[model samples]
Target: MFKRLRRLRLSSNIRELIKETRLDIRDFIYPLFAISGNGIKNEIPSMPGVYQMSPDVIVEECEQLKTLGIYHILLFGIPSHKDSCGSEALSDTGIVPKTIRAIKAKHPDITITADLCFCEYTDHGHCGIIDTKLKTVDNDATLEILAQQAVVLCSSGANIIAPSTMMDGMVWMIRNQLDKAGFSHIPIMSYSTKFSSAYYGPFREVAQSSPSFGDRKSYQEDPANRKEAILESLNDEAEGADILMVKPALAYLDIVRDIRERTLLPLAVYNVSGEYAMLKAAQTAGIIDYESVMIETMLSFKRAGADIIISYHAKEVAKYLLDRK
Candidate 1:
């Protein structure tokens, strides 16, 4: 005598009622690239639907997101100037800060998360101040700047500060600085277990952050280490991170699940550029049904224990959900 699991699958209403995981527009944080210009909205070739927009254009995009009921956005900046220390990133007039103000002025209800990292601002495309002796990122020095950058971003009206530099003690320093600067209410979203993976190829093109000499394996986590991955998130949690993330979501869903099991904080996963580009390519080639596959893939992240999803597919998914209603 077998129990009848098939009974739940017999009807769409029953399936919906018994579903263990569900996808929602609120579960996503859409990523946007804000460059220095006006009237610009250039679609990234690799990431077809994504764009590198000027502040004006980005504000327009935010309006569209609001209409679709997606109120959260993660912002990355591309400065016209580059330097060894990434000095532009620390300025009050920097691209991200200006963009944040512009976005907030037009859409005060939108929750803006500014991504803090030096790779897009630095000449050599490293994540932080370089250690010439070791030819690697200077972790402690970078933490100091990260603290300052957090203050700058928060002052510009960023609702959340997301430090993606993967530097050691980053969350602790940023949290300390934010609290001291009278922004103790601001939450920090740390990219706790970012793996140095080839899946970031399209992101390099969009952000123009490819390292000039070597890879980020020196600072970013190695993809093959499981125990190390779990510990990384736990360390960030201990450092006072309000939220934790696992990057390259599809390839590391196990890590997401493991970290979810260990921590009570809200967990986020980055459905990165390469993953989005691959599915778009397959759809253009008529190899897959894009809409069905996209929904299924998003559900996979939820089923694997992701509470928040940052993805290039966010706008499209929102449209799909709106259509369903």
Candidate 2:
């Protein structure tokens, strides 16, 4: 009876009827690049159409995204200062804090999530507080700052605090610290299996969070392993991460699917900047239609089991979905 699977694709109606995956505006989380000043919206040269915008211009960007029916946003803030410890990450007066207030003020309906990492605010651009003697990011020292940063982000109206730092025990630390600081309701999205991939290069250009000295291979996962990702995801889940993410979605779809099959928790895939840049580059070269390729790229994540997708292309993809109807 199952002799001919090709029959299913024989007609458009039949193909639609048998379709296992579909794209939606709700599945997207727009990653906004927030800068430290007003009246500015500078483009990230590596990432076409992605910009580093001032708070005022960012509000305008939000309005456009809202009009496209994109509801979720993840913020990466560029602060005016940096230090060895990245203290600005926790400051109520910092770029992230101020931008969260601005976004919430303009659109109370939008779900604002803050990227809870210190790279954007650190001189050395390490994700944690570093120990120069050992030339390593101190796990305990980083957790202390992450907890405070979580509380401050919650106070500033971040609906979700996503810890992209791959530090051990970070989820429990933030969860415990937030609960104790009266922000018990705030959710923590942990980047459980962020691999050290070349796919993050354009993102570094966009967020400007690249390390000034050493690379992040010590903390981020090595791209060569899959079993390690499962172990890390399980660890984060047990430690109270409200959601788990596998970053750089395209190359890591196997891990995304692995996590999806293994856990009940909602899964997120970061369609990282470098991945987007590749598609953008190809589309510009007339190799493929941008909108069609973009839709296919996103729905691939859905088919592989991403419940939410944090993407730089969310706005464009959302608009495409809207026009389809």
Top-TM-score structure, candidate number: 1
For each candidate, the alpha-carbon lDDT, in order, equals: 0.95, 0.90
- Deviation from native of the Cα of residue 175 in model 2, angstroms: 0.2
Clashing pairs in 2: none
In model 1, how large is the Cα lDDT of residue 103? 96
TM-score of each: 0.98, 0.96
Give RMSD to native, each candidate.
1.2, 1.6
lDDT of 2 by residue, 51-73 (tens): 99998998888888888998799
Put down candidate 1 lDDT per residue, 65-137, tens digits, no spaces.
9999899999999999999999999998999999999999999999999999999999999999999999999
Question: What TM-score would candidate 1 get against the native?
Answer: 0.98
